[model samples]
Target: MPSLNPASRERVLVLLRHARAESWGETDHDRHLADEGRADAGAAGRWLAEQGLVPDHALVSSATRTQETWQSLAEAAGWSLEPQLDDGLYSAGPDTVLDLVRGTSSEARTLVVIGHNPTVAYLAQMLDDGDGDPTAAADMVMGYPTCALTVLTFDGDWSALDLASATVTAFHVGRA
Candidate 1:
């Protein structure tokens, strides 16, 4: 983990939604992570673990691909953190997304959010700082390819964050 001030112990985090996924019809919300998406999730998870960015808690969309993504990520990173499955996140907008993040408990310093696009893409754009590798972040800005990740950071607990209080510090996706 990067050096965060003690004041930052009350963290506000927003994990980028995972990459591509099968359409809802094919797999429903519980069975959507494709083979490729699985690999991508692993890569993204490894990246997160390597950075010591593991979350104490996770907020996941109650969608198959999203759940599958987290499963693969947990497998790769050896993380056993508890995650809440949220039905509300399947097609929520950015404001709801912010609300989901803010819902994290005060004692939890880190949080991971897994969900669908448009909202995730928009959130990444809002939080990105251009400090991470440009080439790596290109997919995030251009499009969130399946299983991609946009890691972000903030100074306070989730509720304290506004639009400008965060920044995307890194982006990751499995190589094809």
Candidate 2:
């Protein structure tokens, strides 16, 4: 894994907000990503790949939009990864998402969560120690737009994760 600081043991987490989707009168769970959303998600994946942040594990929401977002990103990045779709992620709150994070396998050095907001957005802000890239932090503070990716670094194991336990290392707003 790429390390920002070699002296400190770090666990990386990438939170991705589902890309833009069209409701089209479907139920919230059935909403699918729009064309622009697919492109945006692809760009986000490419950005991660370029940064050498390939996820060892991905937790994705079972909702249609979230699934589409992950699929687009994985394909664009040419990743061989397969995400675990959980029903619990559908409209989950920060605490619930945190639990899912805490349960991550120890062997997986890099983890990603692709879901909805304001849970994903709120969690990023909550975990951030305000010690990373200022411009990236500012973009996150503004709000997590469609396909936005927030990269965080924690000093401990996943089971020890909690509010303010990590620092925002990088943030990217995927291109449309």
Candidate 3:
């Protein structure tokens, strides 16, 4: 993990959509990551490491695919932190997920959240302050596919986070 100055007020939030999964499963939450998904997730982890975006904490969906994605990504990134697996994230909408993010501990300078589809995409769009990397923002607007991740930077505490509070610094769709 990257060392953060204790007095720094800036925070980084990484939003990641779970990697691709097999189409058929006993239940939606039971599906595990496809072989390709595992490779792609590793690519995403490598990218995060290259960018020095290691997380101090992580929030992951309890769904099998999301759990698998986090495992693969963490392995590639050499992340040792044990993620908090939240059942709420499995079914959460953007607003609900935002509330969960707001509840994050202030001590965490960098936080990552791994979850599912539309919610992750919508949350990435919703959090943008519209004043960061234009190309990255454009790519995010174009589409958020499986293994897609967005990096955002914001000031102040997590409790104060709200719509348009953060600036999107980077975006990537990992593939391998």
Across 80-151, the per-residue lDDT of candidate 3 in tens digits comes to 889999999999999999999999999898999999989999999999999988898999999999999989
lDDT values, one for every candidate: 0.72, 0.88, 0.92
Residue 110, model 3, lDDT: 93
Per-residue lDDT, model 3, residue 122, is 97
For candidate 2, lDDT tens digit of each residue in 43-143?
Answer: 99898888777788999999999999999999888898999999999978999999999999877778889999899999999998877777888989898
Candidate 3 ranges with C-alpha deviation above 4 Å: 1-7
Q: What is the lDDT of candidate 3?
A: 0.92
Per-residue CA lDDT of model 1 for 40-141, tens digit only, reads 788877777777766788989888778888888888888998689999989888888888787778787778888878788787776655654466457677
Q: What TM-score, over all chains together, does every model reach?
A: 0.83, 0.93, 0.96
Worst 10-residue stretch by lDDT in candidate 2? 1-10
lDDT of 2 at 65: 95
Candidate 1: regions farther than 4 A off: 1-7, 10-14, 23-31, 128-139
User: How many clashes in each structure?
Assistant: 5, 0, 0
Q: What TM-score number comes out for model 3?
A: 0.96
